[model samples]
Target chain A: MASPMSITALASDTIINAGAVDYLILAVYFVFVLGIGVMASRGVSDSVDFFLSGRSLPAWVTGLAFISANLGAVEIMGMSANGAEYGLPSVHYFWIGAIPAMLFLGVVMMPFYYGSKVRSVPEFMKRRFGTGAHLVNAISFAVAQLLIAGINLYLLGSIVHALLGWPLWVALIVAAAIVLSYITLGGLKAAIYNEVLQFFVIVAALTPLTIIGLRKVGGWGGLTDKITSAAVKNGTSAGDQLNSWPGNDISGFSSDLLSVVGIVFGLGFVLSFGYWTTNFVEVQRAMASDSIASGRKTPVIGAFPKMFIPFITIVPGMIAAVSVSEIIEVKAGGSVPGGSSGKGVAYNDALLYLMRDVLPNGLLGLAIAGLLAAFMAGMAANISAFNTVVSYDLVQEYLVKDRDDSFYLLVGRIATVAATVIAIFTASLAGNFSNIMDYLQTLFGFFNAPLFATFILGMFWKRMTATAGWVGLVAGTGSAILVWALTSFGNPWTLPGQGSAFLAASVAFVVDILLSIVVSLMTAPKTSAELNGLVYSETPREDLVDANEASHPWYQRTIPLAGIALVIVVILNILF
Target chain B: MSVNTTQKQHTAGILDIRNVIGALLGIYGVILTLMGLFGDTETDKTDGINANLWAGLIMLAVGIFFVAWVRVKPVVVPEDLDTGGDDPAYMEKH
Candidate 1:
């Protein structure tokens, strides 16, 4: 069933050939999503309502949106493809990489963020590092959002064109209009609600496919049995398909990239911490909850569902490796672990093939709709974050200070439209990257690795000066670029893409911490009064043990709940 | 998850939008699912499987649950805090 055309064309052809029911499913999703936007728009009176959802979200809604916002269609597609290629090891991204960091965000950092009451993540930078560092963070963040959003739009348009055979531009325009309409009108609250709905849609869509696929493969034992047989038949090591710990031998993953050390230290610590803790894209939802306690619990609540996602996404990919015959086999070479030497699927078309080959028409339509919703949710989240940072941190705080609240609100709306348009234009340029997940992870390393360092020191150590923050950020980014160049330009010593990113991020983080410490020791520290509520030790926003909270059972507390999550993750790693 | 009892009687905050969207999608999902299952003209697009029926039921369950949640726990605004429109808590000074 694979198309004999270009990689992009094959995906479009698959979607274009989908049944009519799929189209109807998509149409309903579009109408309902737009309706939510219109409804959300009715109460917007100022910037706060638009940007922060009026600080009225409950923990459940915020939690779902927080994870859904990160659960972009690209993530689904990329991770699934990784599953097909790498097998069981890919599950590590979920179990080990994501859960711990999310819990850390909620249990440790939320007090500082919610207590200080900064509007945007970069605004937090301004509070901790002063104007110069804030500008660096705000400007970098704005650029990153645009790039990521543009990538999402490009992917959505490509998927629609692949599935429906419509012109890519038509799909792009329609998607852009729908996202812009709802996001511009409803703002963050509308975006949050829609994301929660999208999460349900995605679960509903993929779960059936996983069940059906599992049944066909004869359950877990059957799946492993078939993949192992295929790998052996194809002149590949079955170990590659079965093992989570890529072994020490040359036949396993290249030593630089697929080691447990790389995954644990580089990904679990530096990369995951940087992306989850500091990046505004995910943090904005947490900051929007009704109370500090609820706000703090957002990410911890999100981590539960996050742990289960690999079952729906990665499992299907593993099934595809053995079940989908059209997966184009490639000649084994560097970094390409031995898999069936038959045909290999387009690295990105794994999920599209699953829907096309596995799902029936009616269910396929719903699945397509869910995936569509996922795409929109991802775009909307980015656009909302972009608008918030641009309008508040960049414009309202610096350029147009003292503008009436209504004026800033209008500016936010305008910025939303402008950012969407810019993303539309940039989407056309997004076809260069081959693997979306790897590319994004690399990008995170580039900017956020150093930023996370700054956040860690700034929040915990009062002696960390503003100049130190700026210097560390610059040095960190510079180090990341240097490491990336060494790897990409074929310096014989560097690791694979993930390894390079892992090493660079680790290097940048260490550099940032050391540089900041040295610089802070030499520079004048901000006074105790100025540092109040900003640093960890001197903050007044610390809530003394709430009598109400204390009275509740220990299981209900955030720490205990997080403890439960940690235990569950540990058990899953051992089992899987 | 307890609803705030201090809210005004008729504030828009009473209606949780999650319920509304959930209910709408769920209802439509059920209709399409039924059409796939009961309608004689249903095509064997999913290898003779009733995919529509299953998907619709899922949506129906999701919709019913959201609607039920809203009915069970209507969100209310806190009486003590401003609705947060143009309020100082929301607005930041340079």
Candidate 2:
């Protein structure tokens, strides 16, 4: 992947003046991206090898890739946007909402998933619950991946459009082609390897911006002073803007008690847990690990970097909120006269405006490439996971049963192309929702919350019946929809901002769990022998973990690493 | 043509992840460092700090570390990676 890059380019809309050095830096990054794909393709010998990197990637690589897959438009632009608007509470997305669930995935959920050896999350559903749940999960997951991929594609295209002065459609196609080539050539290994590289590049791109931004704001103390002063100027409490606790703006709740509850249970328990533990995009990265220990440690290993990401992402947005003219004006309740994405100079414009105002040529180019890398990584993760589910879980399982391994591999490549094309159409849908984070949170609530409930209950309680699985999923999803409509449309609304998304997810989780327990009692369960690897009680302890884990050092071991990560996150929470 | 059709391909674990990371960063570092030396240093935007120079040097150091890391600890490549499925026990025992 280290081949010297001569990245293809079109005329820059000339939004930013990119010197020769800038082009060269971007060129080098793309060359590496494609070179990794070429190198990875050599390793693919069958469908399994293509989809899971032959399940042979080391922990460090998988770990970086795990976080990188998620270090997408959501983490960078979305969180930055949130930071500009919400301030200190935005850190909650990392410390409170994300880390603990990631640790749970590494410690508890991963062993179950790794030991079972299912190709996709939906496949696991089929084996445990039956075709009804399987189909629901597979279809919903596939749809979600496509829609999210579209969001990434939309973000990626925006960059290409700015760079080339191309029409939006052309930029979207060009961006899709760039992503498609690597994935179609190399499959999951390329995606994962590029993700790791993207992780580093993303860090490289953002670190400079964060440092300069912090320096410009006269460091941390100065930043807080400015943010607090601005809060007072806006006629709001500084605590709402500067403190992490209660986080009135983040939850969009007026009552401090309700806000805390909403954040703790809604975000921490339901939404974060739902997405991190059950989403196939993230899970697929861990599943590509070389060993059970490595697989279990993947998310935990990623947590270290994940917890620190807000510094570069949200912190920059905080800097921009006080610094950038556009952001400042938007904060003052004014609009960008010729604003691109909807209502006006949106909160989402915070990062891009900061990048424009502060970064010089060479650094600016590198930063742009970094944003592009994150977008590609996100879209690549979605496409890779989408192809696997379509090929292995749906097509091979039902329509084209008993297909040869080579046949499925071909089907996978085709599915990659299909997902990319579909994503191009869906990219437009992303623009209308440039309050994209809200919709994304809504999606996670609908798809992942109920699914997490089913997975959690079924994994721990072997008595949970297959009938309960399908019924709970359907009911949980419906309840989340119902809540979303009532709150957004009219009378007696309780939550605002992301609070409604969290409320919907919490309701979904409760609905799924309660219905699962009740329906399970009324229905029949698969016998213990049949439930073997699929359920907790039916499976032995040895099956859940690596027997040789004791031989490794404490750092290399899963629990100790996870324990260390948990401690660090707790400290970060208290400190921040 | 798909790579899967050919069987004797054995480059899986041999191409270490470090090598790829090192080479890319090294290229980026060298280019940025060169620009910092020869190109116009945009001090106005960065409040007088040489961002390209400083960032480049740090990236160069880290890239070298990764390259050295591979030499110190190489990845082991299995002759066959056909070991990636459900433990045969799941189906046979059932």
Q: DockQ of every model listed?
A: 0.28, 0.25
- Residue A146 lDDT, candidate 1, scale 0-100: 81
lDDT of each residue in A315-359, candidate 1, tens digit only: 988877767654534212223321211123464566766666677
Tens-digit per-residue lDDT, B3-94, candidate 1: 33444433344236656666666766776676666653233334445666766776787788777766665654443334444422221101
Give the per-residue Cα lDDT of candidate 2 at A12. 31
Top candidate when judged by DockQ against the true structure: 1
Top candidate when judged by lDDT against the true structure = 2
Candidate 2 is graded, for docking, as acceptable
Residue A80 in model 1: lDDT: 79
Model 1 off-target regions past 4 Å?
A: A1-16, A246-258, A328-345, A432-441, A544-548, A553-555, B1-7, B11-15, B39-49, B78-94
Clash counts per candidate, in order, are 18, 2
Local distance difference test, each candidate: 0.75, 0.81
- In model 2, the Cα lDDT at residue A293 comes to 82
Question: Residues A246-321, candidate 2, lDDT per residue (tens digit)?
Answer: 8888888889999999989988988888889998989999998877888898999999999899899889989999
